[model samples]
Target: MPYARLLPPILLVFSNVFMTFAWYGHLKYRDTALPKVILASWGIAFFEYLLMVPANRLGSTVYSAPQLKGMQEVITLLVFAGFSAWYLGQPLKWNHWAGFALIVAAAWLIFLE
Candidate 1:
């Protein structure tokens, strides 16, 4: 458990990847049936939960719940940024970066002692 502090964030990053896909990966498949997409998203979310639950459980040991949430939020944005540009073919605009920067700054505040 030497990597306790580091591990949770890494796990969260992976978890968020799955979550982002589960939530948004269907955008490109607009013609797909709603029920089919829902089922697929659920399948993807199962994996997300697998990683997310452990990430939270382990993160609680080294970080407060707020801090862990902060970490996950930031990681979600970062992962989504990449997935947006590369997978969804939608790059973030400058305004989006500005908004995310502010959010990240707010997350930093939670980490302050």
Candidate 2:
């Protein structure tokens, strides 16, 4: 298989890692000033967009828009699940697994011809 097809998902994984931090990492620092937290999140989000934009562009070469989006969502959840557990100390519940399973099923449908 061509390695170019792997670039998008790899980049998306990195992008989602940054995004999960940008979006929820602040929860651990809720005592910090809101403006400072917002600024910090924005800074983190900048890196996320840098990877995310290219991931989508490259992914478009091998996948449709919906497929790319579905892939990204799945990557996002996977990244967030780890971040939530390790960084935020929030473990996944049974419901979270069930919800994620549904999303995975949706991704399967998106990838199906």
Candidate 3:
């Protein structure tokens, strides 16, 4: 397989990490100041966009638009699940797992010809 096929998902993982931080890391600093938090989140999101744009561009080489979007959604859920539990101290419930499983099932359908 071409190495390019692997680049997008890896970059997307890094991008998601930055994106999760940008969107949710601010919970820890809720008391700091709204404007400051927004500014900081935007700064972090800039890095996310950098990786995300290229990830999509590279991913498009091997994956269709819907496939790429589905992959990203699954990745975001996985990343967010971990981040919510570890960083935000919010443990996932059974319902959350069930919901995620349903999403995975949907992904399966999406990937089917």
TM values, all candidates: 0.99, 0.97, 0.95
Query: What C-alpha lDDT, on a 0 to 100 scale, does residue 12 get in candidate 2?
Result: 97
**Per-residue alpha-carbon lDDT of model 1 for 86-110, expressed as tens digits?**
9999999999999999999989999
Ten-residue region with minimum lDDT total, candidate 3: 1-10
After TM-score superposition, the amount by which residue 2's alpha carbon in candidate 2 deviates from its true location, in angstroms, is 2.5
Score candidate 1 by lDDT: 0.96
Q: Of models 1 and 2, which has the larger TM-score?
A: 1
**C-alpha lDDT values of all predictions:** 0.96, 0.94, 0.91
In candidate 3, position 109 carries an lDDT of 78
Displacement of the residue 35 alpha carbon in candidate 1, Å: 0.6
Maximum-lDDT candidate:
1
RMSD of 2: 1.1
Cα lDDT tens digits, model 3, 28-76, are: 8778999999999999999999999999998988888888888888898
Candidate order (lDDT):
1, 2, 3
